[model samples]
Structures are given as C-alpha cells and as structure tokens.
Target: MTVRAGREFLAIPGPTTMPDEVLQAMHRPALDIYSREMVELTETLLAELSKLFATKGQSYIYIANGHGAWEATLSNVLSRGDKVLVLESGRFAIGWGSAATAMGADVEVLKGDWRRAIRPAEVEARLRQDKDHKIKAILAVQVDTASGVFNDIEAIGKVIKECGHPALFMVDTVASLGCMPFEMDKWGIDVAMSGSQKGLMTPPGLGFVAASDRAREVHKTANMRTPYWDWTEREGPEHYRKYAGTAPVHLLFALRQAVNMLLAEGLENAFLRHRLLAEAVRRAVAVWAEGQVLGFNVAEAHERSNTVTTVVMNGNDPVSLHRYCKEKCGVVLGVGIGDLQGQAFRIAHMGHVNAPMILGTLSVIEVALKALDIPHGKGGAEAAIEWLGESVGA
Candidate 1:
C-alpha cells in the first residue's frame, strides 16, 4: 500500500505556503465594508504597502491577480498605439507585452538570451538609438520566474538615465518582491507591480501597483484609462475607491499580519535568508549535475534567481519526476512552463520557507532521483546539509 504521512509540502514558485499568522488573520468573519475599523485597516495597509515597495509614491490594492496588475498598469500609463519597449528575458515579460498589445499599445520586444539577464549595455544602446524618444515605457521583469533568471532592475534604470530616455521604467516584481532587494524608488522605477501570493506570504487574489508621480501624471493624459483601473479615481479620497467598490476585507487583515511579520523579521534579513536557501539548493543541484544528467537552466550564476531555481533534466522526463515526488513523497514541485515544459522543473525557496523545510524538499528529491533510477551523483542531500550547516543566517 502506498503510504504518506505528515503535512504535504508545497514548493511551487507561486501560491507559496502562507504563514499561520496570515491564515489566522483571515479566519475571522468579514468586517463591515464601510466601518471605521475597515478604514483604519485600509489606511495602515496602504502606508505599509508603500514602505514594502520602498516607495513614497501612491500604491493601489486591487482584488485581482498579477495579470490584472499588468493590465491596470498598461491602461494607466499608455494610450492606443503608444510605443513600449519590452525586454523579453523570459515568458512572463512577453506575456506582459502581449497584454499591452491587446490594449492597442505598440510593443517592440528586445529578444534576449533566455538563460541570462538582460545586458544593461544593450538597453542603453537601444534607448540611445531612439533619438526621437518614441518609446513611452520600458517593461521588464525583475526576476523571470519561468527561467529562474534575475535581472538587475537598478542597472536597467541607470542605463535609462544614461541614455536620457524619458520612457517610464516599469518592473514586474511578482516573484521577486519581498524575496529579494527591490527598491522601487531607489531603482528609479516609475511604476512597479506585484502579486500577493509569491513573496508576500499571503493568499492569491490581491494585486499591488506602486506608481510614482510621473506615472500618475501620465495617467492624466493617458487615453486608455477605464473606470475600474483609473489611478486618479482609485487613489482619490473616496474610501470606496480603495477596491473600486467594497474592499476584500479579510485579505486586508491577512496582508496586515503578513506585513507585520515581514517587518519584524526585517526585509534585508528576509532577502538574505532567501539568498542562503537558494544557494543551498544550488549546491545540491551542483552535486546532482555531476552525473551529467541534470543541469541548471540558467547558465550564469549571478543571473540565477533567489526565489526559484529551474533545473534542466537533459533527456529525462520532468513530468514523471514531478509525479513521483508528489505521489510517493508528498513533496509538490513547480512544473516547468513555456519553453521549459517537459524538460525542466523548479524548486522554490521563497515565502515562509526555512532550512528544515528546504532540507526536507532536497532529501525527497534525492530519494526520487534514486527511486526512479535517474542518473544522479550521490550526496546531493549531503552537499545541501553542509552548505546549510556552515551558516546560521545569511
């Protein structure tokens, strides 16, 4: 008989394990939509959200997912036929650009090596070539979770400044925010978008957008603005505009608790912890790769993401490996998406994950590799243990 025990571990890149504090915060009954308590929660939550993004600019919360945030951002800043320079580092950025296209925005994508981060020099050169300044915005992902590659958003911003480009700098931090160092204001990001599920340690259904004064100013002249996504109307003094109507009361409570936990732990500490865990995972993967059957999808070490690690299986079938781990070991792993389908898998080391949790995931993966006779070097778990033991914190 197949036997499995203990809590099933979810190691997917998104919809990460939520902290008990957040779950408990959302467990209660919904509050009155217009009550003073709700108003206070809304005020405190928006203020803290601003601090979370490291921005003094206005932030709006929506009862939508990251896709909605992408659409909302496009509508708020671009009009029909406006030009946007999209940096295609991976699948998601292209998806964002496609959303812009659907909104009647003209998108010019800079095809990049899928395995590496976008080169700042290339961005600078491209912007310099646009002497007429036709590009209204440059859209990129801080970390392309699909490829497990992290781009330097700050470097991109600096390049834009070097070229003297007036285009708005926009970044999608859906997978990187709270897991890594992302300073929206410090990075000179005119607009930034993120979702609640990944690094925020909250349930899905909440989308966040932090807009600088320039992005808001663009909103005034932006012809594509719709009532639901109009930044001015949403950010107005009216309490009803907070959610464009009644608020997602319980989500606000959960977010408040999650933000409190993150602040208490300190954002830097959180980033370091995620970095250390990701390194441990990498070390383990390195050992496994010694058998020459496994390899990293991302070729460059510096470009690797701190939130997720995508592993190439060479000739092995990723679907079978994922199925074995889920059914036999009760460890859920992220399936490869886009170009990586059937060939790669992902290990997420973000959100509320800790050493023991990651160690358990590594151990299970090692066992599955052996059980399935997948060619892998011995001692992957040992390598992970050694690396994790060397440092108490990062």
Candidate 2:
C-alpha cells in the first residue's frame, strides 16, 4: 500500500540527507594515497576542520564513529588512575562516563534532569570542594542528542576558571558542531570531539578530536593506548601517520566537500537557518498541542534544542504514529530514546534541512495523526507555514 515516487525523507538527527554536491564530490576514481592531490586534501581537511571547531590547536581525523572519537580523546590525555568529573545530562554523556570507567579512570558524575541543562553553580561547587584539585578533567557534552538539551559550555568553562580548578575542560560536540556555534579556543575547551554525520553533513564513518596545547601535553605521559587510536603517533612525522594507515579516501572527499559547503554558506547563516527552522517547527508543535493530547518533552521553549524537538503524546501510541508517518506518508521521524522512549517521538531540524522540508514533514505528521485517530489540533501546518513566512519577512 506504499507508493514510491517522490524523494524519501530521512529526518533522523544524524546521517542526515546528503547534499548533492557532497555526494558528487565523492564520485571519483580512487586516487593514490601518497599522491600530492591526496596529501593536499588531507591537509585541507585538517585546516578547515580547525575552522569548524573554532580551535587553532591541533585537530586529528580518525576513521571511526563518535564513540571512537571519545576513546581517542580519553586515551590521548588521561592516565590510568586519573579522576575525571563527568556531567550527565543525557545518554551520551553517561556513555562517555562509562568509557572513562572502563579505561580505569575514577568518574564522578554531576547528574541533572533529562529535560534541563547542566547547572554551572553545581559544577563550581564541586570544583571548589576539591581544593587539592584531585579532578584531572571536566567531561561534558555540548548537546546531548537523546534528551535534546544543550549545556552552556562557555559559561561552564568560566565557572571552572572561577573555581580555579586545573582540570582540563573536555567537550563532546557530536550533535552540535556545525549546526551551532562552538568556539572551542574562545571557550577554553582543552579537548573537543565531534562526528562527521551530524552538523558536518557527511556520512558516519569519521570522527574528529581537537586538542589544545595543554591537552596535547598530557598525551606525552598518558595511558597505554592502542596503536590506531594513539594520537601521538598519528600526529607524528609523515602525512600517513595522521590517519595511522591508509585513509578513508572517499570519506575524506565527502568531509572536504561538506566543510567547503559550510564555509561557503558561512557559519552565521548556518546557525541562523537552524535556529529559524527549529522555532518554526516548535511553533507548529505548539499549535498542535492546543487542546490535543500533545506536549513537548522539554518544558521551556527556550530550553528546547535547535537540533531536534522531542514531542510527547499524552494518550496515543508514539510507535503507531511513527509507523504511520513512515509507511503511509513518505516521511521518517526520529524515535524517542532512553527516558522518553515509546511515550514520545522526535523531529530533527538539523543540517541539510530547509523550510519546505519541515513544512512537508509537519503536514505529513498532521495527516498521520488524523488517519491514526490520534487527537491533534488543526492548522498545525498552517502555523508552521506562518512562522516560516514571518521569519522570511524578518
């Protein structure tokens, strides 16, 4: 009962719809890995990545996922018994803490509600109590993908400095890198890690780790890391050492194309686009939430994420709605995770998404709600459209 004519919409938070330019950029004959063209590409990729992460310090490319990037960041700077304080706002942050635990580091978690951001005061309090500064690193995620909550990393860095804690400030920017503004050097982030699939608008095979001079110094006497994940060797002599071995040449092409597109559009316009699209999507959700059994998982609108909006269904099956939207309509919505699973669903408004795409998605969701007999307010799509018009006008 499904017809396949139009373009299939994939609205997941990561591995978003690929840009035609990026796809075409990767469509080429395989080049010699040691050739001048390939070396130039590798260098350009590193240079542009530094710009994207806003860190002038050393940045490394890895043929791995965000999780591997996590390991690289940890192993590069942390010793076996190092004590790292982790801030847990959602699943990914907790996952990082788990990695630290497995790596034999003592992890102290500062927990926060899934809906709220990390409180800087709590962080400051913890650091102040540690007068001797047993904590070696402060681990945090800029945007936790599961709960769609963003922490004020810059403010937290300020708090760390105010407390005079010498712990390294490490941030995971997997879901928020190019989609939002991340000033790594400006915020004094010792280490910043991210993946290729999210805001970078590439496929999911690459992860990045950017380190400050202080963090790189820690690597000199760090834990025993595997040959591949060791940043020292990767950052050592020879161009091939950067990737540890043969590079993911095609993925490198995609990354180069993605970074070029980002720089071409300018980061300011990119952030503004994501912000406007997120507001419009929330506007539509608010309209639909009027008298229906619908609500936003995040309580405050301002607290909501520009990356994705988690929608809660009061009396309906989120699975059924998600399935209907996928099967009946040509739209793919992200599933809720962890704490909100099955009770809620998510809509991604991140990279490579536009007004038409969001509008179409809202319309399809409205249709699915109606067909599935779920109670939802009318004119949700209209509200989104209205907001889009107003944003364009402004």
Q: Which structure among the candidates has the greatest TM-score? A: 1
Worst 10 residues of 2 by lDDT: 1-10
Clashing pairs in 1: none
Model 1 over residues 1-394: C-alpha lDDT tens digits? 3334778999999899999889999889989887888889988888888888899999999899999999989999999999999998889999999999999999999989778999999999899999999999999999998999999999999999878899999999999989899898988999999999999999999999999999998989999999898888886777989789989988888889999999999999999999989999999999999999999999999999999999999988888889988998889999889999888999999999999989999999998999889999899889988987887745
Tens-digit lDDT track of model 2 for 1-394: 7653588898788878889998998899888998999889988888888888898898999999999999999988888889999998878888998999998899989978888888899999999999898999989998888888888999999998888789999999998999888999999899999999988889999999999999888888886477888977887768889899898999999988888888899999999999999888898899889856888877766678889888888766799888888887878999888887887888998888888899889998888878877877889999988887887875
Candidate 2, superposed: residue stretches over 4 Å from native? 1-4
> What overall lDDT, based on C-alpha atoms, would model 1 receive against the true structure?
0.92
- CA lDDT, every prediction? 0.92, 0.88
